[model samples]
Target: MTGGVRDKDRDAARDDTLRRFLLPIGAVIGLAIVVFGTAFLYDKNGAENLLAGIYQLLGNNAGATALRNGGGDQFVAKLVLAAMALLVGVGGVWLLYTGVSAVVGLLSLRKQQRIIPWVFVLPAITLLGIYLVYPTIATIYQSFTHGNNGAALANPLANYATLGTQDFPHVILNNVIWLVVATSGSVGLGLLIAGLVDRVKREALAKTFIFLPLAISLVGASVIWQFVYAYRPPGAPQYGLFNAIYTAAGGQPLDWVHTQPINTYLLIVIMVWLQTGFSMVILSAAIKGVSTEVVEAARLDGANERQLFFRVIVPMIKGSIITVATTVAIAVLKIFDIVYVMTGGRSGTDVIANRMYDEVFQFNQPGIGAALAVILLIAVLPVMYINLRNLRHQGVGA
Candidate 1:
């Protein structure tokens, strides 16, 4: 009886092991069926046709006819494509990670421990290589080539040389101005607002109001500000908010966005407005994280409110301050939407990104566009390095 019991236990262990192995295999196969089935349906127009048939069966002949005519079909196709993409993207990753993890689980304990992290990380690394690394290298190579045909440049450095001439210098300067003014203004104002709001009774409400503008897209914000900066000629009723206020004070209604020198600054104001809230939220958290004991000690040591804030609070949150400044600086450097929508890079308000877009798409100067892209990448690298280093120093990702 004891011998039979031992044999039964051995058989049960074998069955349990088999179940663990079979279960993941079944899950993986099932996931593959769903993901691939979705793809197949989308590729063959089966999903769209089915939707159209449903519309017809529901007595919406017009909707069915629209679908047949490519309008509603396109919409249905898009929905299917989106669903397929999500399934393939998310489901594919899950399948890969889960399968690898299960395989690793079957290995020896030491081997599993050694291989598990790679099982988790290799997919991300592979994706980054495919998307980011390849495109970047290709762009750098393309920057040296002429036009869309990829012909060799007579002068390999011609594209870079072109940036130094004509209106490019002014555009570069505008980017620099944006970098300085927008970054400093956003960080400064955010810090100020964060400090003041921290002392207020209704902190969340005040922050909600200040943080609201950060929710607007740069394009949407530009569109809204277009009305605020909208200009009609002098002696006409000013429709713009700023111009209306100016004209009400008996001053001439001036074009805010089209006016040079000031126009760039006005554009910077929108960025500052959008970014200040982000800065405030980050700095506020940092400020709150500062030790109250240290603050009280500073007060006991004869530090006034201003001195305590500047010397104590500011220094404690210096990492956050740097992070916000660098983050805003990066955004300012890549600024295109505001300039593109508000002025179309006219009136001397162009920046690197907008110029790159015009060069590539509008002007069809692929070489110059690639060159500008490389230059922009070069500019952003240092700021990224600084931010990363600060994060490391703060023991993030340690």
Candidate 2:
């Protein structure tokens, strides 16, 4: 009877391991079949056909014509399908893994502990991969192909070469101006405002006023500024607020949008105005979080207000400052709405994002747009990696 019991135990362990391996494999196969059947029922080309059929069912024949004339509704449909596929694919894979893990947990307590966390966290990780990873790969690929027909470019490097044109220098220059001024100015102003308001009687009211600009969307803010900078071609009653004031003060009614480097600076001011509030709020929180005991100790050691702010408070809140700066920098890199709405990238006001837009849609040079986008990505990745590293060091998300 003892020998019989030992044999039965061995058989049970073997069956558990087999189930652990087979369950996930079978689940994946089953999911594929379900997704495939869903697509196949719509059309023989699976998901692609299903997407087209769905578009047709919605009375969108524009896609059929636009596909041949370049990307249009069909391109949009495919993009939607791609996103859906990413979500579905990720969910299916996780479900397979989770199901297998849960079944195996029935035999092992350690596996049970592992299975629960995986089930909870898997959805978030999958969505992250779907949104961040897939678009990045697709954009990189699209950079090398023709925008119109998706044909291989005559030279794979041609798109990148176009970005090096004579006009591109102005674009690069404007972007650099925006990066330096907008990022630094916003952070500095934010820090200053936060420090000043900390000891004020009506601190909440002051902060609310300074932070109001950030509440406005970039496009909306641009529209607001448009009235301020509007011109009436000098001596036509000066309709624009800025021009009116300038003419009254005996200054010329300048065409702010058409002016080269000046227009860029003007655009940067809008960004700084919007971002300063965000930085101030964040820095103010960090300031409040600084240890009062340490601050008093510094004061006792003969530190004045200026010295304390510079030497003590600044050092302690450096991480928050960097975080705020990096966030603003990313916004600067991808800035489009203000430039697009205000100047439409005309004159010398064209930044990288606006140029990319003009290349893809306006100029029908998708490859160049893709290349520009890739360049923007390359510039941003290092900053993001540094930001992530800083956050990790600060024990954020720990």
Please give the CA lDDT of all the candidate structures: 0.86, 0.82
Residue pairs in collision within model 1: none
**Residue-wise lDDT of candidate 2 within 133-248, one digit each (tens)?**
89788888888766454667877677777778869877887888889999999999999999999989999999999999988999999999998899887648888888888788
Worst 10 residues of 1 by lDDT: 38-47
Candidate 2 Cα errors over 4 Å, as ranges: 1-127, 147-149, 297-303, 387-398
Best by lDDT: 1
- Give each model a TM-score: 0.84, 0.68
Our tally of clashes for model 2 stands at 0
Candidate 1 ranges with C-alpha deviation above 4 Å: 1-21, 27-31, 34-68, 71-92, 103-115, 147-149, 300-303, 387-398
